[model samples]
Target chain A: MLVIARHTLRETVRKRLLLAVVVLTALFLLLYGVGSELLARQIRERMLTNVDTALPLAASMLTLMGFYITSFLGALLAIFVSMGSVAAELETGTILTLAARPIRRWEIVLGKWLGLATLIAVYLIVASLGILALTRWATQYTPPSPVPATALLILEALVILSLGMLGSALFSTLTSGAVVFMLHATGWIGGLVEALGSVFDSQAMVTAGILSSMLVPSDALWKGASFYLQPVTVILAQNASPLANPFVSATPIATSMLLYSGLYLVACLLLTVRRFAHQDL
Target chain B: MTVAIETVDLCKQYGRRLAVDRVSLQVESGEVFGFLGANGAGKTTFVKMLLGLVHPTSGVAHLLGRPIQDPRSRLPVGYQPEQFRLPEWMTGTETLELYGQLSGASRQDLRVEIPRALERVGLGGRGNEGVRAYSKGMQQRLALAQALIARPKLVLLDEPTSALDPVGRRDIRDLIRALRDERVTVFLNSHLLAEVELVCDRVAILHEGSVVREGRLQDLLKTSTQLRVVVDAVTPAVVEAVRPFAHAVVPNGRSLDIELLSPDHVPAVTRALHDAGAQIWEVRPQQMSLEDVFIGIVRPRENG
Candidate 1:
């Protein structure tokens, strides 16, 4: 299993997708960070009056942008990296040589998942730290605790990788990628429904949205990250602040969702191993 | 004559199609057994079932006296599948090491065997080259090297030399033969009649998923009935004299072509030919080549 993991990690590191994701995310942070800082400076000078909320507002706003961008890009990277873990190996016939050996199929699946998870964790840690450095250097603003948010972001990336790996096991790459993308998109949109339900006293809509979040749990994790990154002042803001919108705050994920994701991945791994074991090459 | 591998009414199905139809075979230890069939004749499907890659529809297979259902049974078995694909990103050395570990080769064993195994496959110093850079033959050699890494007691090779050059083929054949000296059983699946004829002690020919014919190579070929008669003078009396022993006779100055019912009939025909005034030069028997037997069994298309 170690050998398999070692080889898999080597191959994955050689893939351009990892470097591409890092470069794109850094470019995004640079542009978004510089532009937002310049705009905040302009507003402060134009008013000819110092606003207490200016720095906090800009810091929260910039963190929110970084969070959103990382969440979306992290999910994208996870999906792209993991979508072909099983199906591509089977299709390309590489698994034939491996399967013909005495190694078990479950070991292979788990090994691949481990390698991909490691890659995702490294990306999240490095990129999140880079974003934090940018926030400090450019705006001289720091959120309450960046470490917790980074940890949550790592978990989020893992969940997404699990989803994509599950899809890869159940279907071909094309179909798997499409289905996972839809699940992600729906999860994001459902976050809105859950938020609106609390404002309008719509229990049915809230139930539907909560159920959707339970189905994927990705949106719930993002909302949790938002709550962590946003300040208490913005949470109570009346003008529907972008950083801590009340609608986004309403649906805090239940503990059960994390268990579901874990169980979901375990089930996916079991099914994949079973299917792959008997699969004729 | 202990059987190293055995299948008891082994069957496999792909959806509605019967890929392997109630096949049973026994391969003795220290023997090279050839599995012959046309394309899509269930050769590969049967091999897959034996390797437990594909679950059998019904029945069971035993490798090295243990049921294939037992994962441990694979430890003593080695396989080179026809459609074998190596991971392109892996170097040849890394690939062999992986299989060696999976096969439970000891560090001491690997230290001595890895390099020698590569050399046996003509991949001596190219171990660091990625599989993608290797030619088809090199990839096949690497596959063969991996399959034989552990000195498995039984080796199942499917077209083991398909992509190899003549020298490479000879090297593999020699390696296979060497395995036999160590009491290893070799189950070879190939359409290469010449290779099978040269190596296989016993062979089973499959046609449309069923074993149509099987036996020792010599016994199968010996079953083909033909007469070879050499006479100093080929005359009408000699032909007429030999007429009762044959279905038809064609006189060719020094040779008399005779139809034979069985190989045993040759002695009687020779006696009858000697009874006549003609001088009998020599009496011989005709044996079918593996190619002849192959073509005879696999019914060719009308146009073909």
Candidate 2:
């Protein structure tokens, strides 16, 4: 299993896609740093009333925005990297010799999952920290619980990664990518609807959103991370506003929902292993 | 002799189509066994079943001594698939190392064996080159190198020489012979009948998902031998006299094509022609090629 993991890591690192990812990540950090510095200066010059409250709220929103984009990038990387992990090998016939070896079929699935999971973890850590450090430097504001926030962010990416692998095992590469991407989009839309429902105090809309989140808990995970990353003052400001926003949560994510997301990740991985083991290659 | 491979009523059905049907065969240790079939005749499916790549519908197969379902059954086995597909991003050495590791070879041992395997397959100095940069033949050589890197007790090669030039084919033939000399079992699946005829000790011909024929190479080919005789005169008396010794005789130009019961009947037919007062110009023996045997078995069933 470790051998397969090493091989998978080496192969993914050597791809030209990784080079593109590195360049784009650098460009994104530079842009965010410049944009935050300008925003911080504007807030100081223009906002004279409630300066303490407005400044921290603005900085927290900027940090949340950075993390939001980071989460998006991380989810895309996870899906794209894992969507072809098994299906492409099957299509190209490379799995024949590998499957015939003495290793168990579950090891192949687990090894690949481990490799991609490690990549996603590293990306999340670096991108999240980069955003946090830049926000701290520019605005002198830091979230109360960065560790749990980052952990939740990492969990969201892992949830997507495991789903992508399951899709890879069950469908063709194109179909798997489409299905997983749609599931993620559904999860994001569900989060938006739930936030809107909360603002209007509509139970039906909230229930509908909850159902979609049940289908794919990625958005719920992000909401949990959002709750952790927001300062109390920012949460109050967002709650007072009449409009719904994705950057701040009025309530923390339920512990039960967090437990469900962990189980969902495991179920996807287990299903992937089972399906691949029985498939004819 | 120990049996290297055995199957009993092995079968694989893809929906309504029976890709393999009741294929029961035994391959003895240290022998070169050939598996022949036309397209869609289920040769690859059968091989996959033996390697646990394809699930059998209803049958049992054993590699070495363990059941096919057991992963350990493949520990001492090596396989070169007909597709010859390897990860393009990997170097040849890396490819072998991955496979060697999967086969349970220690990293320390692979550090020595990988280079030796590459050298054996004519890729000694080219091990560092990525497989994407390799030509088709080079990739084939690399594939074979990976299969042999662990020095498996049984090697399953499907069309092992399909992508090779004449020189490459000769080199592979030599390598197969070397493996045989090392007392290794080789189950070769190939369409190159001539190559199979040269290297295989025994063979099984699969036709329409069934084992239509199986035997020692000499035993299968010996039954189709014919004697060709040239006589000075085409007379009814000579034909009538040799009729007792030949199974069937057909006149072709100035020669009589006679199928005798055995090579021992050759001298008897010659004496009979002499006794009929006919001058014997020349006598030659013709042995059937493996191609003839394959076509003869598959074509008739196909037509009927």
Candidate 3:
């Protein structure tokens, strides 16, 4: 299993996709830092009516954007990287050699999962945290919850990767990506629905959002992260505001959803293994 | 003698289509066994079932004296899939190293065996070159090297010479013979009748997901009853003159295939062609080749 995992990581790193992702990420991070620095200078020079609200809100907004960018790109990366994990081997006939070996099919699944999981972990720590560090260097303020919020973002990306693995087992690589993207999109749209529900104080709308989250808890995880990143005082003040807020969850994610998300990831991985184990090459 | 492969009513199906129907056969240890079949004849599926890449729907198969259900049964087996692809970015050496690791080769075994394995397949000094730079035949050889690197007791090769040039084909044939000489059991699955006829001691012809014929090469060829007669000019009159003695005559260009009622018709056939003043280039008793036997079996099923 370690052998397969090591080789998987080596092959993945050699992909042109990773090179492009890394370069684009670095460039985006640089530009964002520069933009933040300019905003910090302007904020300091200008007179602010309420520094408390202004300072944390500015920092939280930047941190929130950073989280969104990293999470979105990380999801794309996971889908693209893992979509071909099993299907491509089955398609190109390369899996024949490995499948003929004395290794179990589940071992192949576990090895590939571990390899991609490790890659996603590194990507999150570097790309997501790098953005946070850049925002901090430019502005003295930071989000209230940095570590846990990033952890939530990482879990969200993993959920996508696990789903991608299941799709790879169930469909072609292109179809898997397309299908997993739909699942990811459903989560995003569900988050919006929940955010609207929170703003409108509608139980039915929140119920709809909860239904979608049960199917894929990616939105729930993001909401949990947002609960940490958003300013409490601002959210409290916005409660009486008339306009709609995208999403401002005052409470963290339900412990049940978190537990279910963990199970969803495991279920995807297990289903992939079970499906491929008895499948014809 | 020990049995290298054994199958009893082994079957595989894809939806409504039966890819490998209930088929059973036994191959003795250290024998070069050819599995002859046309495209979609379930030859590949049978091999996969033997290797455990495809689960058998029913019946049983044993490899290296162990049931195919056990993963360890495949540990000492080597397989090269038809038209396999190596990671294009990996150098040949890296490819071998990776396969070695996956196959559970120790570091010491790899250090000593990889260079020698590369040389065995005629890619001795080219291991550093990336697979992207290698030609199709070279890549095929690399796949073969990977299969043989571990020196297994059994090797299953699927269309081992399909993409090779004439010289390359000869090299692979020689390699197969060498494996035979080394007492390695070979399950050679191929549609290349000529190549199989050259190397295999025994063969099985499969069609429509069933093993239609299986036996020693010479024995199967001997079962063909049609006699071939080559003449310089098989004109209409020459065909007419021999039609009386021949049960069925199929004249194509300079060759005439005559179905014989009895072996005694050879003299009458020659006399009839001579009476018509046709020059007979060759009139010896025609023996069945592998191709003739294969078509004889597959033609009926294909027509049905």
Task: Give the better candidate number (2 or 3) by TM-score.
Answer: 2
lDDT of 2 by residue, A1-281 (tens): 98888888877898866777778987998899888889888988898876677778888888888888888888899889988999999999999999999888999999999988888898889988888888888888898888898899899999999999999999989899999999999999988888789779899989988999999998898888888888887678677888858545767889899999999999999999999999878
| Candidate 3 residue lDDT tens string, B118-144 | 998889999999999999999999999
Question: How would you order the candidates by lDDT, starting with the best?
Answer: 2, 3, 1
Candidate 2 versus truth, CA RMSD in Å, comes to 2.3
Q: Which DockQ-derived CAPRI band holds candidate 2?
A: high
lDDT of 2 at A51: 67
RMSD (Cα, Å) of model 3: 4.8
What is each candidate's DockQ, to 2 decimals?
Answer: 0.58, 0.82, 0.59
Top of the candidates by lDDT: 2
Query: Considering every candidate listed, which one attains the maximal DockQ?
Result: 2
lDDT of 2 by residue, B1-304 (tens): 8899999999999999999999999999999999998877898999999998898999999999899999999999999999999999989999999999999999899999999999999999999999999999999999999889887999999999989999999999999999999999999998889999989999999988999999999988876748899999868898899888777889877789997877778888899999999899999888799998888788979899
The C-alpha stretches of model 2 lying farther than 4 A from their native spots are: A48-51, A239-247, B230-232, B240-248, B259-285
Clash pairs for candidate 2: none
lDDT of 1 at A149: 72
Scored against the native two-chain complex, candidate 1 gets a DockQ of: 0.58
Reference-based lDDT, residue A1, model 2: 91
Between candidates 2 and 3, name the one with more favorable DockQ.
2
Pairs of residues clashing in candidate 3: none
The lDDT for every candidate, in the order shown, is 0.80, 0.90, 0.86
The TM-score each candidate achieves on chain A is 0.90, 0.95, 0.93
